[model samples]
Target: MIRGCIKTITCGKKLSRNTKHSNTSNTGNSNRHLPVYAKVAYILGLRVSPSHRRMGIGLKLVHRMEAWFRDNGAEYSYMATENDNLASVKLFTDKCGYTKFRTPSILVNPVFAHRLTLSPKVKIIHLTPSQAETIYRRRFATTEFFPRDIDAVLNNKLSIGTFLAVPDSATWQGTDHFLSDPPKSWAILSIWNSKELFTLQVRGASRVKRTLAKTTRVVDKALPFLRLPSFPDFFRPFGFHFMYGIGGEGPEAVKMVKSLCDFAHNVAKERDCGAVVTEVSGQEPLRFGIPHWKMLSCPEDLWCIKRLGEDYSDGSVGDWTKSPPRISIFVDPREV
Candidate 1:
């Protein structure tokens, strides 16, 4: 058996610029951002065979992964896991010296729960990969694990497409119009179908929750026979749309988010998807108005970070140990 394995991808290094000069110069110390992203290695899919556990296999794998990251010029390494996974938590924090940091929530919405009407004042437009990348590079530049390869994500087989919702007052007729001058109160959404590529395994209380969800499925399946709209089978192992690349903050931010949610639900319904899912920092304002249920297995996911390489001892990176940490993470859709 392949006792354990870990996958890592290198993110960019020193991706900070002074807002005024747009340069990474130490000359202006006051203008330097505190959360300056240096080179980071994202570790994913660390696993050990149950039979091979407690033999230091997990620790050896982690040590090798960190070594690979350091050799590849990564100054920091990070990974995400569910809060309740005590084994993973211990391996990363106690054995690996990683610091526990961000807490982000994964939200799941049944596609057929309720129909939400979009405002007449807004128009939802489909976007090309290039168009979406242009907007995301500008908007999500500061977010963690934001893909440097937006075009790749947009072009992947799993990617359905990207969309934007903007005010009708902007008089936007097509996707190309935003290239010149994008609207102020606009929101971006990227939809990915995970049916063919992935599935979420229910565990613990979630197994019981899945049992309860069957009742809803029964009602949903009967709705059409009763002359009502019926929902797709959510208990099916796959068949979900993942929403990502979401960003917008205006006075109408909440409304824009709702419009996107409605639009996403429609997309999922058209494909007969089980449900739609997305994760955001718990503090993200977009969490409002979107329908979601608390999952026993996924109440909150943890993001852990650790420094590596010679710069690991840099004092400027700040002592994460000293303060109450608050992090806003943008989960990479490609990884999901």
Candidate 2:
């Protein structure tokens, strides 16, 4: 019987850069003394039947996947799981030699019937694909887990567009010298339409709870002005917009990030999406700028990584597990 299964994908590579060690837990420097870039693979959707528990099937599956990753030129392999998943934690860390690498938080905000109000002084400008690609390559190339095929991601059909949020007083100078003379306080983010790819449904809801949810939706629709806090109809398949490449600069950057999030919320509402979602590094200061409901947000999403190859061609990669936290992370929308 098919009791266990695992999947892997070569997402991209991490740049080799000198990183400072932080006192924070779980955030690490991905590359310390490695080559210019190291290829990386991601493992996901590992499953083993409950009846086959403790049979080592999960471990075997992970080993097989690691072999495949190594064969495909991946130097590092990583996977994500909830912090409370003890079984997964043990299998990956204790048995598989994977280290607890990063702890990023998944932030989710439901699309409310009422549109979010954007600051009158904030102006959002949509950037073309080429323009967006240039900015990402120049600014975030050194970021950990940054995809080498960023142009493909920006040009993908699912990507709605890349947007820049700045004060109305900021002037546009195109992409030519924007980076050198960037706005004092500005934020940028890209939106991916996950609806066309797949939808999510919340199963096993109590009958009473389901009825209450439906009732709330009805009331909110009838009286939109109430701006009632109502849950989306998760009993059915619903879609969401994922925001990625979220970062900013200057003192007002935090406010700009919030403005961009509000703008995304409105766009999701317009698309009839159930929610707007994003994931940011746990220690990321900008995390406070991304609005999310505490009830819907995940405090810590654990990511475990393992060095696939034993051959250290040019000295050790320096233990990434001991690396420090970075202020910003480039979350690949394709992963979502």
Largest TM-score belongs to which candidate? 2
Candidate 1 structure quality by residue, lDDT tens digits, 1-336: 212212332122243454545655422222233224455677767778889899998888888878877777776777888888899899899989998877888888766643445688888888888777766665565455565566778889888888888887877655445544557677778899886677654345466667666666567555634433333344455478888877776678768877888889888877867678888877877777466756422557888888775556554435433335333455667666
* Per-model CA lDDT versus the true structure: 0.68, 0.79
* Pairs that clash in candidate 1: none
Off by over 4 Å in 2: 1-36, 314-317
TM-score of each: 0.78, 0.86
Prediction 2 global C-alpha lDDT: 0.79
Ten residues in sequence with the least summed lDDT for candidate 1: 1-10
Model 1 clashes, total count: 0
